[model samples]
Structure formats: C-alpha cells, structure tokens
Target: MRSDIVPVLELGAYAAHIPYHMTWAHEQLPYTPEHERFLELECISDILEHLL
Candidate 1:
C-alpha cells in the first residue's frame, strides 16, 4: 500500500491509489513526438466515471 493513502484510511475514509500504465509528459523531460499520440486519450475520464 502507498504511504500517502495510510492517513486517509486511518481517518476511516476511503482511498484508492490507482497506477496508470502510461508515463505522462514531465516538465523535466523533453517533449517527444510520440507523446502527442496520447494527448487526446480519454482513459482518465473513463476511470474517473467509475471511481466517482
């Protein structure tokens, strides 16, 4: 389990730590041409719908 989620669980509230398979663009990394391919992906929205 993630340490960050421990506090929420201690408070008796629900928490989840979902890991994404994709690596999103980072400020420190150079922008690659291939990153554009995932720019329009809607996977997060789909995940949020289920989580919410």
Candidate 2:
C-alpha cells in the first residue's frame, strides 16, 4: 500500500488507490503522469458510482 495515498484516503479526500491488474504484472507498461491521472479518475468514478 502506498503510504502517501493512505493519508488522503484516511482524511476523506476525493482520492483513491487502485490495484493493478494481473496482466500488468506480465507486461512492462510505462508509468507516467497521464496514466496515473487516468487511474485516479477511474477509481474515483467507481467509488462515486458505488456511493450514489
């Protein structure tokens, strides 16, 4: 778990920690800011859907 993300989640901010897919472990994907932002938005939308 990312300790940096823990604080945001614990503090009830609009933040999320998304787990990587098993396939990601088999492939070498470049970790970039755009990818991170996309994942964060995806997780946030998922959480919102669950809540609402």
Candidate 3:
C-alpha cells in the first residue's frame, strides 16, 4: 500500500487472518475463478484457526 493509503495487512505466527483487498471500478471488472476460490480459502482458514 502507498504511504498515503490505509495499510491492509497482518503478519505474525498464529496470527492468522485474512486481509481485505477489494477494488472498485467504473468499468467492468475481470477476475478468475481461482482467485475467488483462493480468497474463500483464506477466510475459511482464518476462521478455523480463530476457532481452534
């Protein structure tokens, strides 16, 4: 992230958490299925670790 923008990241062992990284556009957006699945897995893993 730029110094002018808000930081969006977490770093630590056992500090598992998904960092939000969204984008907005005036035109249409393009994304691959693999990217979506990866995002889901990250959230799921974070939740699982939090619960355990």
Candidate 4:
C-alpha cells in the first residue's frame, strides 16, 4: 500500500487501489545538480512543499 493512502486507511475510510501508468507532476521530485550532497535538504523541501 502507498504511504499516502495509510492515513485514510487508519481512519477506517475506504480507498481503492488504482495503479497509474503515468507520473503526476506533484509526485515527481524536483531535480537538483548536487543530488547526493543535498539529498536530505531536498527531502525536507519536498515535505515543506506538501505541507503548504
């Protein structure tokens, strides 16, 4: 199960397991030149973006 769907399941709500062939923009991580060096920073950025 996807991590995004866990909260809904925990609430005892119904959720369908649908697979997609294409990736959505929001689902895609931003590209960075220094991927290895800034990996943790990138993750924090993603989390903050989602929160907002």
TM-scores of the candidates are 0.35, 0.29, 0.20, 0.34
Q: List the lowest-lDDT window of 10 residues for candidate 3.
A: 1-10
Give the Cα error of residue 35 in candidate 4, in Å.
36
Q: Which candidate tops TM-score?
A: 1
Among the numbered candidates, top lDDT falls to 2
- Tens-digit per-residue lDDT, 1-52, candidate 4: 2344445555665443333557676654444222221212223345454346
Candidate 3 residues 1-52, lDDT tens each? 1221212222211222243465434222253222211223356555664356
| Higher-scoring candidate on TM-score, 2 or 3 | 2
Segments in model 2 whose C-alpha atoms lie over 4 Å from true places: 21-45
Order by lDDT, highest first: 2, 1, 4, 3
By how many angstroms RMSD does model 1 differ from the true structure? Answer: 12.4
* Winner by lDDT between candidate 3 and candidate 2: 2
For candidate 1, write residues 1-52 as lDDT tens digits. 2344445555666554444555444422342123211222335565465456
Q: How many angstroms is residue 46 displaced in model 1 relative to the true structure, after the best TM-score fit?
A: 7.3
Clash pairs, model 1 backbone? none
Compared with the true structure, all predictions reach lDDT values of 0.41, 0.45, 0.32, 0.41
Candidate 2 local lDDT, 1-52, one digit each (tens):
3345544545655445565554443343334233222225345457676457
Query: What's the lDDT for residue 42 in model 4?
Result: 26
Is candidate 1 or 3 superior in TM-score?
1
